[model samples]
Target: MRDVKACRVCRSPLPRAGRGRPPAYCSRACQAKAYRRRKNPPVPTPAASRRPGRRRQIAEALWRIAAERGLDAASMREIAAEARVSLRVVQYHFDGKHELLLAALAMLNADNERRARARMATVDVDDPRELLRAILDEFLPVDEQRLLALRVFAAYFARSLVDPELAAVFLHDGQPLEELVATVLTDFGGIPDPRREADLLVSGITGLGMDVVHGRRTLAEVRATIAYHLDRLGGTGKVPGAEAPGTAVV
Candidate 1:
C-alpha cells in the first residue's frame, strides 16, 4: 500500500508518487488552482521586488571602503569585492559611479528617517519640546553608524552644490525631510507656520550636526542647545516627559 494524504490545494487525497517530496495538489485542477493562487494572490499592491536590502548592504560596504580609502581610489571592482558580490551585479543595479553614489545617499536618507522615527516613537512626552528633543538627540554623534551617515550626507550635500545634475536628485530627496519635520511640528506643537518652522528647525539641526561631527561641540552641549530651542518653541511646557505612546521603540 502507498502512503496517502490530503492535498494542500484542494483537500483531495493524493497518491504516493515516486521517491520525492509529497505532492501539494491532488490533481491537475488543484495544481492549476494552486499555481494561479501563487501567481495572483489577493494581497494589496506589492512593493517593488528590487533587492533594496542587498543594494543597501553593497552601498554600506562601498561607503566604508570610500571612507578608509578615498572615493577616487575605490573602484566598482573594489566595492564588489568588499560587498562580496560580482562586479556585474553592481553594474547591473547601477549605471556607474555617480549612480552608486546616489544610491548610497538614498540609503543614508532612508536609514536616517527610519532611525529618527523609531526614536521619536519611544519618547514619552507629547509636547513639541520633547519630540523635538527626541529627534535632535538622535542626531548626536554618539555612535559610529550615526557619525558615518552624517559624514556621508555632508559630503554629498557639498558635492551636490557644485554639480548641477547631482543637485537635482539631492534636492528631490531632501524635500521629504523638510515636509516630515513640518508635519511633526504642526501636529505636535500646533506650529502656526509648519513649513517655515520645519525649514528653521532643519537648518538649525543641520548646522549643529556639522559642528558636532567636527568635534566643535560636546554631546551634552548639543543636547542642551537643542533643548533650549525646544523650550522656546513651547515643547517643554506643553507636555510632561513620560513614557512614550504605544509603539516599538525602534
Candidate 2:
C-alpha cells in the first residue's frame, strides 16, 4: 500500500478510506478559508463562465413562472421545460409538489425580507413610531416585489387552511410580524396592552393585504385606512404632524 499524503494546511495524514477526492485540509476551518480564497480569486468577471447550479437555476426559472402565473397554474412539467431539464431532475431535487411549493415560498419570502431590510437600513428616523411606520409600510402593495409577495402569501394562506403542514409553516413565518408589532407597540406606541395591540395591528395588516391582493382596494386606499386606525391608536400622540380627530389640544 502507498503512503497517504499529508494535508496541505495542517500537515496531517490524509484519510485513505474516503469514497471521493482527498480533502486538502484536515479540518473545516482551513477548508472554509481555502474555499473562500478559491471562490474570490482574482478572476475577471467576464472570463468567469460559471453559471448558477442546476438546482438554483431551476428554482429561479420556477419562481419567474410562478410570479407570472399562480403556483397552481405552474405545473411541474412546465417548470421542468422552462428550466431546460428533465422532469425527473426537478423531482430528484424536491420530495413532492408540496415540498417544491414550500421551497419556492421560502425562497421568495427570504428574498423579500432581505430587500426590505436593505431598504429599512436607509431609513434614519429617530422616533420609534416613524420607524415602525417605515417597516410596516414596506409590507404594503406599493411596488412589484411587495405586490408579488402579498399575492403569493395570500395564495399560501388560502391553501394552508386545507393543509395542516402548510398552516404550520405559515404560522411560523407570521410570528416575526407579530413580534415586530408587539415591540413597536410597547416601545414606540407606549401601549399598555402590547400583545393585544400587536394582534389587532397584525389582523388589520393581513386584512388590508388580502384586499389589495384581491384588487378590492388600491394600495393608497389601504395605506390611508391603516393610517386612520394608527392615528387613533398611536399616531396622534407619537407621530408629529398627525392630528387627533375632534381634539383642540395641539
Error of 2 at 203 (Å): 1.2
Q: Which residue pairs show collisions in model 1?
A: 124-243, 124-244, 129-235
Lowest lDDT 10-mer window, candidate 1?
241-250
Per-residue lDDT of model 1, residues 133-247, tens digit only: 6666666677888888777666666667888988898777547667867766776554457788678777878888779888898777877776665654553323224354322
Give the residue spans of candidate 2 off by over 4 A.
Answer: 1-53, 64-69, 235-250
Local accuracy of candidate 2 as per-residue lDDT tens digits, 142-166: 8877877777676666678888988
Indicate the residue-level lDDT of 147 in model 1: 83
TM-score for each predicted model, relative to the true structure: 0.62, 0.65
